[model samples]
Target: MLLDTPVRLGIQIRPQHVSYEDIRRAVLTLEDLGVDILFNWDHFYPLSGDPEGRHFESWTMLAAWAEQTEKVEFGALVNCNSYRNADLQADMARTVDHISAKGGEGRFIFGTGSGWFERDYDEYGYEFGTPGTRLTALAEALPRIEARWEKLVPVPTRKIPVLIGGKGEQKTLRIVARHADIWHSFVTPEELAHKVSVIDEWAAKDGTDVSNLVVSNELQRRTTEDADALYDAGVRLFTLGFDGPDWDFDVVRRWLQWRDGKN
Candidate 1:
């Protein structure tokens, strides 16, 4: 388990209602806090609480973050798979991969999923396909993504870690077992354990060891007991999110201390 004892920590700094300066400050603080990974959402606008809220582009910011932070790994929490061509996505990731490889120390965690936001589709002039169709697109694109990664000139500094975030068991977990280095999902701890069991079962049949997978989830509310419980369930990476870069280091610092104590 990644966080079983010395759990790795992550932060999702979703820029909502805050300016770019504050966001930059938050990122720097997270780097200082020793958060393992930093993430941002991929939508053009806000997803919850406010429809007309401040937001930033995901991959563009990630590119900047790659150069800005030397310590923490960074990526989109979940890039909508439907937006970009698979080859294009691969190239973008490769570029960021190299940019972040300060002195050959690259840590770009590529996270993505089938998109679900209709507003993004409508506003961006993309086809709002059905869920099944979206998943099918993702399925077809994964291979092309991998192929492009292999062929991209000056390949990623290291084997870029692929993180797939989703909750669907049958389809999503299956894909995770096949291609992902880290599989992120959302649910209660009980549900998470069950899903892990199913993912393990799939892995056994596929001759893949999912145990090496870094299980991750976003923490909307933080708690010590719950954090420990998640760790006990073989979840190593715990992510806490703050919107608009209100930049509160207290929660991040607490988690860091917790991680140190566990170590």
Candidate 2:
């Protein structure tokens, strides 16, 4: 898990209970503040606060951000692989990648996961399959998604990096070993070390070299010293979450200062 990768900061601007203008402004602010990545989650309803609060769809908002921002890579924290058809998802990602490129390389990260949100599945009329089934589908769909990207009329500006979220030792890590360019999880440093070892084992079994894989973790609850330990534990990407209705960046600013010091 330890590679010579620079420490990077990301922000997950939660889309619940917020106006589009507010969300747009936050995106611009984060970009100006020099965040390495900007992310939002894919959900139909608010994860916190009022359950039926105002919320935006993920991919549509991402397309808008692709046109609006000039810098800072962006994506869903981890898109639910069970939501959309795999090929369609790839096409959407490719289009956004081109849109964000602005005549140069794009700033899109294809972060995905085997979904676990029952509410999203139930409300959307999608079958809420068992976790094992969902993961199996994800493992099956990824290759098709990559194939679709290659066959698309306008290919992506570059090979889009796949960010797989979760640390399940059996299926998720195996999937990550096979496909992911980055791994994001909220596990503790000790858990991270163990999971990385498991992931390495899976990588070896799959005959894949995952030493170049970037490790990411949440920073909202961790102290600077805690972050240092995480960095020492091989986490190069730290993400801070800002929920909507009053998206505060003061804490984010402090972390940014800490991030700058690390660099």
Candidate 3:
């Protein structure tokens, strides 16, 4: 675990029950407020509130964000690997990576996962396979995604960081050890510690080094003490999510203060 890493803050702007205009404003607001990363989830419909509420596609919104923001790094909090072809996903990520560049490297993080949410799969006509199958597919897809990135013309501005989100010790942690640049999970400090150890063990087995894998976790309902404990346990990136209709900046402001204090 990289315990000495400086603390960074991220915000997930949930794209449910909200207009694109509202999302646009929130993106700008978060960037202006000095957030380290800005994320949105990849889902066809709203995750919470009215199930059939206003929603938008994730990659399209991300392309828009790539052009709109100048400073903050952004991407889907965790893109469902099953939703798109791995090669296409890589090409799209590369294009957005170019789009986000401002006289330098792009600010896109390729956060992805095996995917849950049966509703997304069922409604979209994708096969809702068993969790094991989905994870197996994800494991197969990641290397292809990486290879595709290399083959793409005018390759990505930087080695786009891969942030894998999950806490499963068997498949997910092993995948994290093999491929991830960062690992995101929602777990207690003790659980995080155990998972980190598991990841380290997997890294050894796979002959990969995860010594610099940035540990990430949510901060939505956590107290400062909780944040402190997580930091001690090895988390460096803390993300807080806000759902729309009415997005709250006050909470963001407080967390920004907390982040600044840590740095």
- By TM-score: ranked, best first: 3, 2, 1
Query: Where does model 3 exceed 4 Å of error?
Result: none
Q: Each prediction's TM-score against the native?
A: 0.94, 0.98, 0.98
Worst 10 residues of 2 by lDDT: 243-252
lDDT (0 to 1) per candidate: 0.83, 0.92, 0.94
Q: Candidate 2: give the clashing pairs.
A: none
Q: lDDT winner between 2 and 3, please give it.
A: 3
Clashes of 3: 0
Model 3 TM-score is: 0.98
The candidate with the higher TM-score, 2 or 3, is: 3
lDDT of 1 by residue, 1-263 (tens): 23333467788888677788988998987898788889988999987767897778999999999889897888888899999999999999999999998897588988989999999999999999898899888988988998999998988888888888886878888778777888887676777878877777778788877667788876668578888777667777778887654567887788889877777
